[model samples]
Target: MDLAERIESLKAGLLGAIAVGITFTFTVFIHQTLTVSNNWVLPAFPSSFEDLSAWVREAVAFGSGFLFGVTYRYIIRQGENPHLKSGAVMAFGLVRGLAQIESISDRFTSQPWLAFVLLGESAIVFAVAAASIDLAIAWRWIKPAS
Candidate 1:
């Protein structure tokens, strides 16, 4: 209703949008970069080495974006709440990021630059999502205690 609340809500939407966009875009770019190269390949991990593993990886990479929307909203809330601000968004996101980076990175070593760009993009997305994550926590999109 108020100006501040309006601004927060708008920003929340933007952060969520950005998170989903970054996750999907990065995954696609990484997938293209790897698949285009017939030499470099992804190693077997949770599943057996097969085309199915690659497909699953593709799905997971894209799905990781879902977390970003929530992650960013919570990060954004931190600035609004002193309590949330005290807790570190980067540190918190670090845990989530591990899976993200690994899930996304495993299949992209074929094109070193593409992988690097993906990483750089991830950092920017993280920065954006961190702010949103603070907000999400403050706004109750995610648990404050988390």
Candidate 2:
């Protein structure tokens, strides 16, 4: 790809990353809130936004977002295919969700329900990221790679 095309890819990726990061963070906050209010008997995840581990969680979320964004931009390229877009989102979500399930299984508490919730959360986050990227592209804020 040419230098300009690479730059456009970077722009698109950055936008996607930001969208994913924000969505992930919001979901986490909601999860924490629900867990706290309901006293859900899930595995010991960070249940409070004020906890020290929240920083680590945020970092991981955004780092994952950056990776997803760059890959997703390349996957969809300049195509307007809805299948490609939805497939990309599902691919990322399933990978993340399955990993979480495996991790939960390794734990003694074995909160399978929590894992499913995480899976759904992953899908939502990716969907939001994809939609945001599409909107950005349509608005000419992010030109897909040529």
Candidate 3:
């Protein structure tokens, strides 16, 4: 890619990452609320909010979002390929959701539904990131790599 294309990708990636990061934050908050309400049996977050682990998780999510943004730009470059877009979103979401499912132990067997929740959350995050990238492209704030 040329320097201009690289810069545009960087800008679009940052925008998408920020958008996904916010979504991640909200998901974490939802998890926290569920924990407090005893509706969720998983310890996805620390008892105290904004702990070191929480920040690390958020950082990872943001980094993943940036990668998704750059890759998605090329995946849908200048075309309306709904199949490819859906596939891309499913790829990311399933990878994350499957990991969550795998992490569940026998002790968490009663809470099998957690896996679906995590899977849905993953899909939502990526979808939001994709939408943000599409918006940036539509607004002419960034151009897809040619």
Candidate 4:
């Protein structure tokens, strides 16, 4: 890719990541509230939201969205329609890949239900992010991959 194309890709990725991060934050907030209020689902958070450690973790999670955006752009060739099927497929692959990691597997061994919920949430968030990015590209709000 040319320098200009690379720059545009970076811009798109950043914008997409910001959009996804905002959406993810809201989703997590709502999920947490409902889970806590209902007492039916117990999510295994590493720390309390108010804790600095939690903030650090959240930052990392948000940053990962940028990588996801970049990857999505790379996967969908230029001029190709970034349709729902592509987005869903990418999200599923990402979620499944992460779930296969030993660290993730070990972390959820004691709380398989929480793992399932988290995995589902991750898939939904990624799928939405992917679709939103594609919409932005289609609308000319962001530059498409080249």
- How would the candidate models be sorted by lDDT, starting from the highest? 3, 2, 4, 1
TM-score, predicted candidate 2 vs. hidden true structure: 0.84
Q: How much does candidate 4 score in TM-score?
A: 0.73
Considering every candidate listed, which one attains the maximal TM-score? 3
**Which pairs clash (backbone N, Cα, C closer than 3 Å) in model 4?**
none
Give the total clashing residue pairs for model 1. Answer: 22
Best by lDDT: 3
Clashing residue pairs found in predicted model 3: none
Residue 133 shift from truth in candidate 3, angstroms: 0.6
The better-scoring model by TM-score among 3 and 4 is: 3
Task: Supply the TM-score for candidate 1.
Answer: 0.37
Q: Tens-digit lDDT track for model 3 on 1-146?
A: 68899998898789878988998888877777777898654554344346798788788889888888888888998589899988988898888767767766554587767777778888999999998888888898988778
Candidate 1 Cα outliers beyond 4 Å, as residue runs: 1-18, 42-89, 100-124, 128-146
The lDDT values for all models are 0.49, 0.74, 0.81, 0.63
TM-score of each: 0.37, 0.84, 0.89, 0.73
